[model samples]
Target: MGWPPASAAAAAAILCLGLLASAWAASAAAAAHGPRALAAVQPQPTTHGGLGPRSRHHRHAYAAMMYMGTPRDYEFYVAVRVMMRSLAKLGADADRVLIASADVPSDWVRAMREEDGMRVVIVENLRNPYEGNLGGMNRRFKLTLNKLYAWSLVDYERVVMIDSDNIFLHNTDELFQCGQFCAVFINPCYFHTGLFVLQPSMEVFKSMLHDLEIGRDNSDGADQGFLVGCFPDLLDKPLFHPPENGTKLNGTYRLPLGYQMDASYYYLKLHWHVPCGPNSVITFPSAPWFKPWYWWSWPILPLGLSWHKQRWDDLGYAAEIPVVLIELLMYIAIIAITRLARPQMTKLCYNRRPEKQGALVQGLIKLAAILAMVAAYTIPFFIIPCTVHPIIGWSLYLFGVLAFSSAVINAFLLPPLAVLTAWLGMVGMLFVMAYPWYHDGIARILVVVAYAFCSAPFLWASLVRVIDSLQTMLERDPYFPRLSEPAQETEFSKLF
Candidate 1:
């Protein structure tokens, strides 16, 4: 039997009360620790066992720009910080190297060299000789062409070049065992510039410069294209096999796909219910703003909120309760309003019975509703605390994209499990915010209130849908009644 609307509302209220009570308990537990306790709870950054005995001395290189004249200096600093942290966690015994133009700020160089414990290599004579096109538009490939300088680092026997936006999930120190010019086949039979192993030599570097001076047209107009042009036979190269038991190695090797899984796989695998086993690294090559360092970007991508938690730890920036409260309330309001309006919108968009109104009226209503939601949610971000508001707006924007895209695809209703997963994410975020160094006594109380006010109703509604869906599946009941059959007979027949 279906629940009455009044009963459902009451249940939601009870859930809210329960959440509030739990929040109070959590706050009390936190109070027991005293004022000085939060410092003890801040997670210590991972420290690497630098250069152990028998470890090969290979260097890892990252190419990035500071854009001196522009206002993107902070961008370079954060990227370098996250990359250095990831390297320190996984690149134990391996040398951390960065290649930047002379225009890069001295502060960035000092931070990487002294604070991050990386070797900063300054390339003063950097310039791009080749011009390339991006999406049929003419552009210079000079910035990308700088990656070629890694090959000129002949001081290192083997080098692993990675983009600054790439995050290491596991110790890829084992990639050094592979032969020269090893890379994964992720970008349409070509190697992704995110992570690749190469033997540094002056000869290869000089040859690449020669390719550039001669006006070699790399079809894609980037480093990846130039590299593909340089090695036309890379696709035909045999799979990489590491030398074992004193065996001799001869051919170029392809790195395992797990070493450089693209961010797209995170969502695709989840949609397919496929398990993404431990990856050696996860690369965010597209969209410079989508890097995981920013709290706003990572949550929209796949992977648990745990990834963001780890970043928060490294950053040591605890979001104020007001920030999280503002975020949670906005999300809850948006989700509740959207879900409530969906049925009417669906009927207006696709009515089984036609009305006198034309299609234009329906389209106009949808467009207005979308515009209203976007404005309502987006305007609040500007008012919230500057540091955390971007994350709040970003989260809402991504969900908005998902909702509208689903409508466009004619799959308006997400599966109950999918909705449940999203609800759980909201709940998990609140709890993460409750941890030490993240909240004060008053902030903790505010968190509890926010949880009760926002998460409770949303959770209750999602749970109702999930339970109803599961019960229907198990009972094998018809989801719709036949209009052709008599209503009295249909109701009476069920008694049999």
Candidate 2:
């Protein structure tokens, strides 16, 4: 009897194993067939290249890059190497000219000659490109010299002048297609940057280079200030502002943002202001925390990490697999717990005083307001600890809640007048602490002002509400002020 039961159990286990083996074999066969099926469906690349009946190429062009200023003392190595790599990837036959505003670094010079072995010219400049605060007019002046120097040497008849930060994504030869003398560029600023193409004109170049100087607006973003002033005078020079979408079709994201320095700041300029040129992508992936974006120009991410989450590639330190896995697991756990707890919490807080619909709407609005505040202020401050400590955080958070509530109530009543008062109150509060007049009496005044601001928001909110209520009563019910009497009405009109 014991033998019978044992034999039966062994036989059953063997049968199960065989079934599993068969299933595994079938799965493997299916996978083998799957890729072949996909291969049959996918199209092969055509040999004719992109110059087909529907070719987008308009004309051939080249850019003259005269940004030979010395790289920031610290960033020279990595930045220059990244530039080389970007250039190598763009391939040979790219119409490029590299010029410098100062003595080029020894290593960069070596790489330009040996490692790259590509055709990049390094020209020395007439003046110290780094001299003076090149903020507005001064910046424009330097740029004019820089461009004049580079363009005069450039063999290409028409070319673009780009900063070191602007790197190539593709052979932008097509920009020359419009047949216009002036080649438009993707303006990195609202006005323009030197990264543009123009048919080298002795007259235009001479005038700009000769008289380019400072202007009010103090306009020192570089010789761009000069461009702004000159564009109107040279109205006959063809100027093309790129469409709002900029350049999307060029596989432009991965373009090197800077051949010299990290150009994250350059990216912000591009994002906020559409320059006159048609450029694609910038050094920074600029979408804020909430949006999902695929800026194809990215440092490689570790496998399975979301692109945004993987952006720490610039840190240059790779995260371990186990650490990444543990973080993933922790995130999953947190999400699960949050989902499970939310309904329970909602039930507990539900049905208090308001109906479900009203409560939901109000709750959503409040949540949006809180989230906006958290995103705009809290998250940024949280990066550094001074403003992020428990005491400071709690105090500001509480203050925001109270102030937001007061503003909401005020809006519901005397909305027009109340909003302006509330805004002024906020500006006063912000400056009360942040502004610096740099004198003893001013310091004392600031302290007193801070104290007053801290106390006055709630008070002002309440007083505004009271005045609003009084005004409402005066409008809806004449008996409150007895203004309905003929004599009083006449007197009121006369006083008004």
Best by lDDT: 1
C-alpha lDDT of all candidate models, in order: 0.53, 0.36
C-alpha root-mean-square deviation, each candidate: 17.2, 25.6
| Residue range 270-380, candidate 2, lDDT tens digits | 222333333442332222221111111221111112222322322221212332233234334433443444433222222122232354554554454334333323321
Compared with the true structure, what per-residue lDDT tens digits does model 1 show for residues 1-496? 2323443454345335334533543353233211211111221222111112322344444333332332234444565666667667664557777775555656566767677777666554334554436543223234666677778666666778887666666676666666668777787778776778887777888788788888787867778888888877877787665556534344577776777777666543332222333366777666655556544553344332444455455653343344445445544544454555554433323222223333564355445434533443344333332223235545544554343333322212325343434435544764454354432345544665675677666656754664454333333333232234333446644753
- Per-model TM-score on C-alpha atoms: 0.53, 0.34
Q: For residue 245, what is the lDDT in candidate 1?
A: 59
How many clashing pairs does model 2 include? 22
Q: Which stretches of candidate 1 lie over 4 Å from their true place?
A: 1-73, 130-132, 135-142, 245-250, 271-278, 287-289, 304-306, 318-376, 379-496
**How many angstroms is residue 3 displaced in model 1 relative to the true structure, after the best TM-score fit?**
52
Highest TM-score: give the candidate number: 1
